[model samples]
Target: MLRLPKYLWFVRMKVNKIVELKTLYSFEAPVFDAHGTAGTSQSAELKNKLDLNSYLAPFPGETYLVKVSGESMINEGIYDGDILVVNKRDRPVDGKVVIASLNGEMAVKTYRDIHGVIYLFSANDKFLPIEIKPFWEFEIQGVVKHVIHAV
Candidate 1:
């Protein structure tokens, strides 16, 4: 579900030689009715509020939501279960946090390139740097915009 702005996704997919591009989608709020419970007033309010989507819209140029699935970014305060906001439309630049595809595997990391050598960096020490040599296959997916941790 990790999403990037349209521009970012386009650039990455192009650079990575991805052959498919899926239609864009949005996130909808789920109903929390507490089914089987005695109907409560709170349920009505929850439904009403959830029905509104105006507040869920992102600012201009932002798109896509992906859930964090690992602890490799914990040192950067991005823990497992966090939701990542990706800007697919943004241009990838040095030092940007990006979602990368390596040999078809996906990862979220800080990207840095030095004289054509790409390095994937993780804030957590448990995860080591991933080097993208000229002979390796990889693609940048998108730039990370924000990380939302659910309390």
Candidate 2:
């Protein structure tokens, strides 16, 4: 069974669907100094080479991808259809964006703690901050380390 936040995409796990965790595509691109033009500007023309694995694989095999949905996190630049890089093994501190299960349903929100009281805050004003409910089952699935949004 698959469950998620309101309006989130359903990741089919039992419908004979295939689910992939990571991709195999790789490309080595030249990095310019300070994201400046490398062809002309001398200040930004220094070329540096690096692999994508440096950022994506800080802890190899510990990261997983999760597709995001809903507008609750629009203010934080997280939108529907965005792919979230979640690190399940990493512990989230206060004010970190996280993937969590709320009462068996999944949700992505900013994790917050105020005077020992924990809360989940939505980036959008239309949604309200979710206070920790004593009777509800809430657990952090992972902390979002990066967001991949297609233009």
Candidate 3:
């Protein structure tokens, strides 16, 4: 996980929506300290401050974004138009959702370990679990930590 300080910021020139920011720039904002209902007005003791950057920031070069493109992971809440937060800096973990390039095709699947054998399982049962054979051009691109739905 990356942590960005409040003294500096970055700028993104978005044509439509917020894309992956690769550079840093100066940023300023008015941080609120009240924990109110999202759609309603409330008061607080001014003990908390909120910032979107705290949730997603300090994105390293290896921690990039990718847009999903299939229905294989629909059951897991990942859709075709969703943007995935992929962190290549971290090693792939068993039983975690990962972005992998299998035979030159990129796909998001659950990395499973069954008796020390690794396999990729699609959330949709229509697909079958793929064993990590010796002949495949398989590579773990990154581990998906966050997903942003387009809808």
TM-score of each: 0.59, 0.76, 0.69
Worst 10 residues of 1 by lDDT: 10-19
Report the CA-based lDDT of candidate 2 relative to the real structure. Answer: 0.70
For 1-151, candidate 1 gives per-residue lDDT tens digits of 3344343322221121222223356446765545445765444334533422233324434556666666677777777667666667776788888878766556788898878878878777655676666555677777877777867
Which candidate leads the pack in TM-score?
2
Give Cα distance to truth, residue 48, candidate 1, Å.
Answer: 22
Q: Summing lDDT over every window of 10 consecutive residues in candidate 3, give the lowest-scoring window.
A: 7-16
Of 1 and 3, which scores higher on lDDT? Answer: 3
Q: Give all candidates' CA lDDT scores.
A: 0.61, 0.70, 0.65
Compared with the true structure, model 3 gives a TM-score of 0.69
Given candidate 3, what's the lDDT at residue 115?
88
lDDT of 2 at 110: 91
For this target, which candidate reaches the highest lDDT against the unseen true structure?
2
The order of the candidates by lDDT, greatest first, is 2, 3, 1
